[model samples]
Target: MTPTLQAFVLVSGALFSIGLLAALSRRHAIFILIGIELMLAAANLNFIAFWHFAPQPHQPTGVMFAIFSIAISAAEAAIGLAMVIAVYRHYHTTNVDQLDQLKG
Candidate 1:
């Protein structure tokens, strides 16, 4: 059976919800980053879904947005991971709650 826009939106919403929960509840830097990435993915899915369902199928705006988002998210993820690695190297921990001071 073919899926509808509502189905895609529902799935996207679910992914966003999970991502939010992970970002808010997790103390580990890596987990939080993962949550953020999940949220980005949901957004990308939304862009594509709307684009696919749009009346003007000739336009590539939605796909373009999704692609740009992916590229930006990848760059952000790399930077975030680099920051996490630096933090770990400095503090010897990746737990957000454990990080209280900003000093080296």
Candidate 2:
């Protein structure tokens, strides 16, 4: 059975909220990256859900957008993880609180 748009939206919002909280409350940089991924997943879900439920199902706009978003997310994850690895190598810890070198 196809899900309603309202249900999809609620789920997406909840996922985004959880992602935001995870991104903000975590001290580890990796956790923040995971949270960002979650947020991106939620957005992807919304795009697909809307496309599936759209009045004009013939249009593939949503699918195209979702695919594009996925590509961008993949690129983001790759670059972000690389940065995290570099930071870990230099700082020796993923904790955000301890890497405060910019403080004057």
Candidate 3:
């Protein structure tokens, strides 16, 4: 069955909520990054859903935007992971709550 915009919105909202919850509740740096990624995916889902439902004259605007966003997200993931690794090496802990001091 074909899904409606409302359905897509609901799903996206749910995904965003879960992501927000994970980001806020998790103490590990990796989990926080995963939550951020989930939020991004929700945004991408919204973009695609809108593009599919809305009329556009032979334009790939939504797809392009989603692709661009994916690229940005990839870069973000890489940078985030690198930072996590660096922090782990320096502080020997991945728990964000434990990382109180910024100065090394």
Candidate 4:
């Protein structure tokens, strides 16, 4: 891999790791969602970087997949945020720790 591509991969990996940590450590639903989005963005960045450095014929496919993934991520965020909002309305709190009623 080229130096630029290697750097991009490293940066994306770091971002993904940080996002994972944030998601895992947070109890607030919205913060967790933000962390998930950050992770998705890191993955998207890696996809785009790989697409840019790929062999010519395979580049377009990577880009296409990246585009599709972006669309899917957007839909996921919308649905997730909607659910969060609904949950907040029902429970009046965004903390996951407060959501114990479902256990019963």
Candidate No. with top lDDT: 1
Error of 3 at 15 (Å): 0.5
Model 2 vs truth, CA RMSD = 2.0
Q: Give all candidates' CA lDDT scores.
A: 0.97, 0.92, 0.96, 0.88
* Candidate 2 lDDT tens digits, 1-104: 87679998999999999999999999999899999999999999999998888786478998999999999999999999999999888888889999989642
TM-score per prediction, in order, is 0.95, 0.91, 0.94, 0.88
Question: Once all C-alphas are superposed, what RMSD does model 4 give against the true structure?
Answer: 2.3
| Displacement of the residue 15 alpha carbon in candidate 2, Å | 0.7
Candidate 3 residue-wise lDDT at 33: 98
Given candidate 4, what's the lDDT at residue 48?
90
lDDT of 1 by residue, 32-104 (tens): 9999999999999999999999996478999999999999999999999999999999999999999999787
Weakest ten-residue segment in model 4 by summed lDDT: 54-63
lDDT of 4 by residue, 63-98 (tens): 787889889989989999999999888988889999
After TM-score superposition, the amount by which residue 26's alpha carbon in candidate 2 deviates from its true location, in angstroms, is 0.6
What are the per-model C-alpha RMSD values against the true structure?
1.0, 2.0, 1.2, 2.3
Ranking by TM-score: 1, 3, 2, 4
The candidate that wins on TM-score is 1
TM for candidate 4 is 0.88
